[model samples]
Target chain A: MRAPIQRYRNILDFALSSLLRRKGRNLALICVYTLVIFVIASLIFFVQALKREARELLIQAPDMVVQRMVAGRHDPIPTIQAEAIRAIRGVEAVQPRLWGYYYDPVFGGNLTVMAASDQELAVDSVWVGRGVARSMRVNEGDLISLRGYGGQPILFAVQKILPEASELVSSDLVLMSEKDVRALFNFPEGLATDLAVTAGNPRELATIAAKIVELFPDTRPIMKTEILRTYEAIFDWRGGLMVVVLGSAILAFIIFAWDKATGLSAEERKEIGILKSIGWESSDVLLLKFWEGAVVSLTAFLSGVLLAYVHVFFFSASLFEHALKGWSVLFPRYRLVPALDAYQLTVLFFLTVLPYTAATLVPIWRAATVDPDAAMRS
Target chain B: MASSPMRKSTLCLSLIGVQAALFLVMLLHANAQKDRAIHQRLSSGILVRRLGLTDLCLFTEARYTRHPAMADRHAAFQDHPMGLDHFPSGSLLAPPTFPSPHARTHPAVPEHP
Candidate 1:
């Protein structure tokens, strides 16, 4: 064991010296390698962070959302449907949700107006999201007038501004009392935009959904699990799309790696020849080359991933932020929660480092096995 | 001459150390931020919607089926027909007809055959 360890150390020393000898070429190679990994790693981190955020927030979503459909369009659900759904077995609670979008021409964006649950706001008061308050330039106690469904301007004093951290889901949200929502939207009484249902047993969610559909055919039931799956698929597709867009660059890098591996320069050939002639076995030569490849690839991987971490979590992934996050004049600037999956990291390692290392093996073996005299002559 | 190799080795070692330290610090910071973000989100009552990159594809594919205006408005809703027979007599009260906020020029209720 001691002998093998010593031998491996010697090979690594030689590999390091050889790498240093070609400082200019190796430095350039490392730079390109690191850049490629940085881009890929940043993309992975950004997408995974977004997915994690979605999953965490989705846990709080109602177990099932029931909406009424009429003539192939979502229509307001009758509040009585909530009573019928509450009677369904396995249902723990049912709440009629009053919510709709109010297009604010001033901001050129839609503000989500929802009735505050369990809180009664004064008829003339409203709670606004941080984004809404900033765009509207309204502070607490300031009244902002918005057009109701009747096209009449209604004014409400700002009660509170939601915290900035919660902007991921509530960037354009406005919360008012049920009375205000009905009066503002001219929404009829005894009707709700939708019904949010909670199941007593998570395992009974599917059963409850089916029962709701049976009771109300026009009702559409959206389960929390379904919403999660939709989000996962959506993110996965976007990530896949990015990979496809970067596919050419990745392929170019791979070709460059392959060329460098298989096409040994005259100086490298002479070095191999000298090692083989000096009683160095083919295996030793192979190990020496392996160490060189390992050092370069491992360094590149670490540097790239580290840079990606800073770019995404610290810098908010500025490069891809506009492309991934939707375009909004009043885009809410929120920090992404940094989360790393061990599985994703492992996948990246295999995809980026392993292939290059493996590619070097064939050429290294071929060069190592050559007759020492013939290699020197060439 | 001998000192040159020593200098090179020291430089390489320091580079590796610096990179490793940077990685460790960033990773620790990320984990801490992740925990705080998760705690904040769980306590805050907010529903997940198409907001970020997911929206790019979701909005393009006509796949915003989860939107309030489009939820269950597709073929899935047509698959399960709930005849009037399913409703218990007097269980569902007739809601007063009111103009829908979105129904501008069209009739509030489409005429059913």
Candidate 2:
């Protein structure tokens, strides 16, 4: 065992020297290989992190959101529907949600106005999101006025600015009292945007959602699971689209690796022959070449993954952030919580490291098996 | 031959060291971002009540409300029909007492406000 270990160490040393001998070519190969891995790893990390963030935040969301559809368009749900939903079996609570979009001409953007139940606001006061506060140049206690449905400017004191930390969800959010929202949007007295339904038993969520549709044919019950699946599909589709876009480059790299592996340079062939002639067994020659491939690939893999982590988590995935985050005028700048999937890393390793290492083996074997004098002459 | 192996091993070790250093830098950056997020959450007011930091929340709110610019704006908007009249004079930071239209009618429905 000690002899074998010592022999492998010598092979590794020789492999390193051999690689250093062709510094320019190997360096170029390592650079390109590392770049390819970096792009793929960054995409995977960005998508997974966004997905994890969505899942974490959505866990606290209501089990089912019941909305009324009129002529295939979302319509305000009547408050009376809440009573019926409340009486349904397995339904824990049914709360009517008041929320709407307010188009601000000044900024040429829409602000999401929602009723806040936790903290009360005076009739003339409202809470603005961090983005809104910044864009409007308004701070706490400042009076910001908005044009209501009646064309009258409704003045509201800025009671508090929603935290910038929650900006991902609240960037364009405005929390106002129900009366303020109703007055601003001119929403009718007994109508709500939708109903947030909670289930007493987690298992009964599906049953309650189905019953909701049955009870109200025109109503749609959107379950949290469906929303999660929708988000997953969206990210997967975008990630797939990017992969397709980078497919040609990836193919080029693979071809380059294949060509290099099969057509070992004359210098490398002579080196192998010299080793074989000097009492080095074919196995030892093969192991030396294997180490060369393994060292280059493993180093590239580690460096690529590290660079990708910094790119996605630290730099906010600049190249793909805009596309994945969707379009908004006042987009919230928030650091995504870094989340890694071991399965994804494993798949990446197999996809990149395995094929390149395997490609080297065939040419190494061909060179190792030949007669030393014939190989050297060639 | 001895020197060649020694030099090669040193080179390989240096390469690995560079990668490890980059990884450490990323870890530190991630930690910084996490700390920033925590600070933002603390100051954002949303978590104040939940975290039992209402005193800090109120103090911050009071400071903002008492600023000269805010006081001036409050006084200027007094003449507007839907303005400072709705706010009780001394209770500028008071919680709303007016029930929303839905809460006014359907008392059974859970009110979020």
Candidate 3:
């Protein structure tokens, strides 16, 4: 074992020296490989961060959601449901919510608005995202009049403005008082658009959800954890796309590797012949090739990771808006708050980098199996 | 033992053909997947409409308005001058007309079937 390790070390040293001598070609290969990996990694980072950002915003916002369904339309649930939801076993609090657009017939487009059922409870207050506040040009205590459904003029006094939470999903919320919500549109009592529920044990969430459904068959219980499930589905779809891209990258790398290893130049053939003539085994040649592949692939992966960080956190993941944002009219231009913990890095390394590097071994193994004299003659 | 460049060219062409075939397969799969996605979206939209799920966001109601003049006119038209021989050409409820091309020259009479 010691002898093999020492021999491998010698091979690696030789490979490193050879690469150093041919810096221009080696560097070009490294750059191309790095770029391909970099784009893939950046996409991954942006996608994960986007999901996290949305979930984080949602986490603080609701535990369970209740929306009214009448004739398949989501009408505001009567305020009475808020009282009934408070009696559920795991529920800690129930907040009735209202959301609508305030159109100014004089102005062309609608202004987004949201409100709560009770002002003092702060249950349905304007959750002003950073972007909405900036765009609406209004502050807390400013009275804004908006045209409701069918041109009914509704006015809301901004009681509070929500501080910016997550740029992913928080940039679009507006909260208001229940009285203001009713006065705005004159929707009757016992009606709410949705009820936000907070349960005690996060583990018993499913049981609690079942209970709620049993109690109110008409309401849809939107659990907060369901976002994670949705993201998993989304990620699975993305993973399929990545499999194709990464698979192609690996195939190309393999072809290049096989061509380089099998079709040796005259100088290389002469050198190998001389080495074999001087008692170097075929295994030694294989080791050298393996080391070369390792060096190139590792260098590419490391550089790609670093470049992905810059692309996501520093440049704000600009290359990935279409997939992550879908067709949202307003997208917040914000840098990803990357969670660069050891676990994430370890996962990424194993998941993306290792698969590509391992693909190089098939060609290396083929080259290694060749008879030295036959290889040299070829 | 030098292999002819033509032989090498043929090998390269074969590899290219293999890669092209693989890529074509991937493209077709992707397109099929995309078509499925569009189909799903359309079906989901229809489901939402059928279920009235979209009604939450976009329900609008239309109510009929009661106007006394229109009601009176309709009632009078339906009654058909039963006790009287001729229909009144002018009524107090009719808006005063200045000289106009649209005004009736005489009272309208009901035609017997």
Candidate 4:
């Protein structure tokens, strides 16, 4: 038992010496490997985190939304539609939601203005998102003015600023009373932007959606699952696009790794041959190669992942943020929540560490199994 | 330099050990973020539900890119690509979200073709 453990330790020691013998070349290989891993890892982390944020925001979303269409364009559904949907069997509750976009001429950005449902805000009071407040240059006590229909100026006091932590969804959001929204948009009293419907059972969402559509032919019922699936598909495909775009870079890195591993320096070959000539078995040499690959690849992988984590969660993935996360001007600046899932790390390992090790092994095996005299002579 | 065997071994071991320690720090950071996210979501959920929040305000270059589910199928194509030209995210976000099956076909059951 002691002999086997000591033998492996000695091999590990020899591997370290061989690696340091050509420190510059090995260091360059490691740096390139680490960079490739870093870029790929950062993209994966940002996309996954953005997906997670979307999913989290949608958790509180209604089971289904009912909107009316006219001439293939979205139109405000009659508030009376909620009463009609409420009578549907198995429907828990239906709410007529009032929400729309308001273009602020002073700021050149659109703000999402919606009426609070469960809680009633003072008709003249509004809750402003951090983005909205910053853009409008208004504070909690300050007043924000908007031009309504036919150039009717509507002014309201800012009651509160939306929390920054929730900026992912709420940025550019403006929450007001139902009456205020109706007045600001000159919306008819009987009309609403859409209907938020909840079902007693999540499984029954489809049945209820179908019933709503059947009751109102012109009405479009959008299930929450469809919304979730849409987001998942979008994010997954976006990540795929990045991967495809980076495919060439990854291929280049793989080729470089293969060449580096295949071309063992004459000095390295002579050292291995000399070791074999002096009572060292082929297995011992092979084990040393394995250790060398493991150390280099593991170091690169660890540093790459660590740097990516910092880049994404801490620094907001500045390198790839534009491609991955982009809204318009005054968009929310929110840091992604960090998560290092085991599955993600495993996939990354396959992407980075495994390829390098596998590339090294074949070449090293060929060199190790050859005649000591031949390897030294060559 | 591959100077002393003991020194080289220590260097190797310490290099790996320091990397592992840094990784552990990152793991802790992720866990902390997760915990904070859960807390924020709790309060944020209540507010969003009360206000009946719709799609996330992720994009704002155009109406189609802003609300994909509600966007008309032809809206993005109608104006050409200029609407989302400033950002590459438009193309990526365009494919899945733009076509509103809800308004047209409304396929109740997912059909695998």
Candidate 5:
């Protein structure tokens, strides 16, 4: 056991020295490999982090939302219907929700206006999101006006700006009192934008929804799980699209690696010849080659993944943020929580490092088995 | 600068070992950080639910984007079913499985009768 261990150690030393001798070539290969890994790893981390954040936030959402349709368009739901929905056996309670959008002419962006049932704001006062605060150039005590649905302007005082921690979901939000919301939108007294439905047991949500639709044929009941599933699908699509776009780069790297593996340089062949002449066995030659490939592949993989982590969690993956994250004017600039999926890392290993390592062995085997005199003469 | 093969091999092996250890440390640090963030974020997320915020405001550009859950699926089809979507974000979403009301194919009264 000691004799074999000593033999392999000597082979690894030869591998290391040979690698250092051709530093320029090996360095170039590592650089290309690192870049490819960096781009792919960065994409995976960003997409996963976004999915996590969305999932976490969705836990707060209502189990079901019912929307009223008029002539195939969304219309203000009659608040009177909440009692009818509550009459459904499975539904615990149905809360009439009032929310709408306001397009800001000054900032050329849209603001989400919502009314909270437990709001503490005084009449004619509103709380704004950090994005709204930054874009509209307003802070607490500032007054902003919007044209009502009746073509008249309504002025509202900024009560408070929401905290930075909630910015991811609240960036374009404006929270107002129920009375203020109805007034600003010139909303009808007996109507709400939609109905928020909660069920006693989540498993019964589907049954509760079908009953609601039976009661009101013109309404659509959207489950919270449906929305969450849609978000998951959208992010995965976006990430998959990025990977497809990067497919060409990955292919080029593979081709470069294949070329390097199949065609050993003339000097390398001579060096192998010299090793065999110096009483090195064929297995020793193969061991040296394996070590050489392992060193380059492991070094590149580690550097790339490390850089990707910092790029995503620390710097917010500014490199590809615009593509993966949806486009918006008041886009929230938030750092992603550091997270790593071991399964994804393993998949990345199979895609990148394994192929190159395997490719090196076959071509090196052929060279190792050749007679030393013939290998040197060539 | 000729070092013993044993020393050279030891140095090379140690270099790879250090990188491997660093990579493991990074993964553990990420997991620890994630746990910390989850606790902090759960508190903030409660505010979102309390306010009845449905859709995440990923893009504040259009009404359809700001609250896609309540979006009017037929908005593009206002003119006709095959009308093209004008919003960029609209195209990214899969055709929503909106429980849109459909005309009854089996009539309450038989057409033949």
Candidate 6:
């Protein structure tokens, strides 16, 4: 019978006071929820960043490359395949590339490869990864000796140290003439690892690769886009595993959140009932509890997101502990650049805030709708 | 009243059971590393046989105690030669059409080229 506006106002006032009265319980719930959401958000953020890096590396590479596989091992294609690939329609240029890893003797394996060409790819005439250059303590034109794939000692004069590139696995990369690669590794004439091809149109990449494969059945043609897809799949599998494990923690937090938000002791219920009998309407009691839920959940979610940002950037999500660092020298140590796309952020907010708020209302509504007289009698 | 209390107890127990089940699932998932390693070794063995390549699938615990690195890190499979039955139908390691000039420097390198 009363005006709806008046009811809303009374509900707001009641809700605020009720929440303030039981601040301790709500605070405890906030702490638990924050910890749970923080972990989940950091993982999601870091995995996404890893995928982006892989995609960028792939996009920056040449259009298509041919790698031969024999007996499940990757074998170098004959340097002769360069001509056949270059002859393909829409192919601009075909360059032979040499790739091999050297056991550093001090640390683990350091990978060094020459991106061979008739002409130099970069202005410096050679490209070396920053990690590789840093590890060897070599500058431009500095000589480093490597035991080639053939186990023969070979020397290379560094052209220029390249920027830190995510595409390479090892610290040492050298780009030079195919002849230089052959000379350094003592590799045979017919064998060169792959042919890096530049093409006229990016869209027609798949068609071009298919044609090359048809011609040379022994070789497999891989496009730049395929490289991106492969890395995406690898990261996706790793992220899927992290999700499976943390999914349990999230469920546990939710059950605890629901219980903490909804549950009220018998004494507290009687007090609320007595207050209702005195003057409070059912609507006022409901509003009071609703405010309590919204305030706690929202505060917790915001804090959790901020904490996750710090965890990802400064702490590197503690990924450094096991797979990413001191344990495996193979894994690089890098900060996660969090990608907060609108959809991702929105989903995170709704899943954290709405459920906990709705959970708070269920118990309160049940208690409020009960007859005020029975509350007094009890 | 008795029925109500019994139902409440049942609900509590059911929640506990769900929690236990979830915990067990997590524990099993975490402990599956040993199983995965064994699977990898067995799969590698099968691949060798299917490819028509002959190699000793030396279990590190059983064989090659003297050279720790070879035993631990390097699996002893490359020593055996590929023959008719062990290698698949398509795998043909053709002898070099022209002698590789680089082959002279590294004699230990395989003769596939």
Which candidate wins on DockQ?
5
The top-ranked prediction according to lDDT is: 5
DockQ, prediction 2: 0.08
The residue-by-residue lDDT of candidate 1 on A1-378, one tens digit each, is 899776776777788889989988888888989999999999999889878877777777778788788886788999988988999889988888888777565544557787875354677799887778888888988988888786677889898887777777666778888898999999999999888888899899998888888888887888878877867876776677778879999889888878987688988888889999999999988888887788788889999999898899888888887655433345666677888888988999998788777777788799889999988888
Tens-digit per-residue lDDT, A1-378, candidate 4: 999877777778888888888899899989999998898888878878878877887878888889999998889999988998999888999988888887665545668888884354677999988888888888888887787877667789998998887887788889888888888889999999999898899998888888888899998988888777767877777688888889998899888888887778888888878988887888788788888888989999999999998899888887876665443656667788875677988988986777777777887788888898998998
Q: A159-261 in candidate 2: lDDT tens per residue?
A: 9997667665566667788888898998999999888888899789988988888889999887767656655665676687779879999999889877876
- The residue-by-residue lDDT of candidate 5 on B1-109, one tens digit each, is 9764557889877877887888888888887886658764775597767876677766554565566666776454232122223446545645534312121221232
* Candidate with better TM-score, 2 vs 6: 2
Cα lDDT, model 6, residue A121: 53
What lDDT does the true structure give each of the candidates? 0.73, 0.70, 0.52, 0.78, 0.80, 0.56
Q: Which ten residues in a row have the lowest lDDT in candidate 2 chain A?
A: A322-331
Report the C-alpha lDDT of model 3 over A8-58, residue by residue, as the tens digit: 666766777766777887787778777777776777666665555434333
Angstrom error of the Cα, residue A43, model 5: value is 1.8
* Cα lDDT of model 2 by residue, B1-113, tens digit: 55533557567868888887876676666556666655654444343222111111100112111111112223422211112221246235443454322244435532111
TM-score of each: 0.81, 0.77, 0.60, 0.86, 0.86, 0.66
Which stretches of model 1 miss by more than 4 angstroms? A1-17, A20-24, A118-120, A278-280, B1-5, B45-113
What is candidate 1's CAPRI-style docking category based on DockQ? Answer: incorrect
What is the Cα-based TM-score of model 6? Answer: 0.66
lDDT of 6 at B83: 11
Model 6 chain B poorest 10 in a row by lDDT: B53-62
**lDDT per residue as tens, model 6, A167-237:** 12223445666566666667788776667788887877888888887888877776766655655654565
Cα displacement (angstroms), candidate 3, residue A53, comes to: 4.7
Second chain only: TM-score per model? 0.36, 0.29, 0.28, 0.53, 0.46, 0.25
Compare candidates 2 and 4 on TM-score and give the better one. Answer: 4
iRMSD per prediction, in order: 11.2, 15.4, 21.9, 11.2, 13.1, 18.6
What docking class should model 4 receive? acceptable
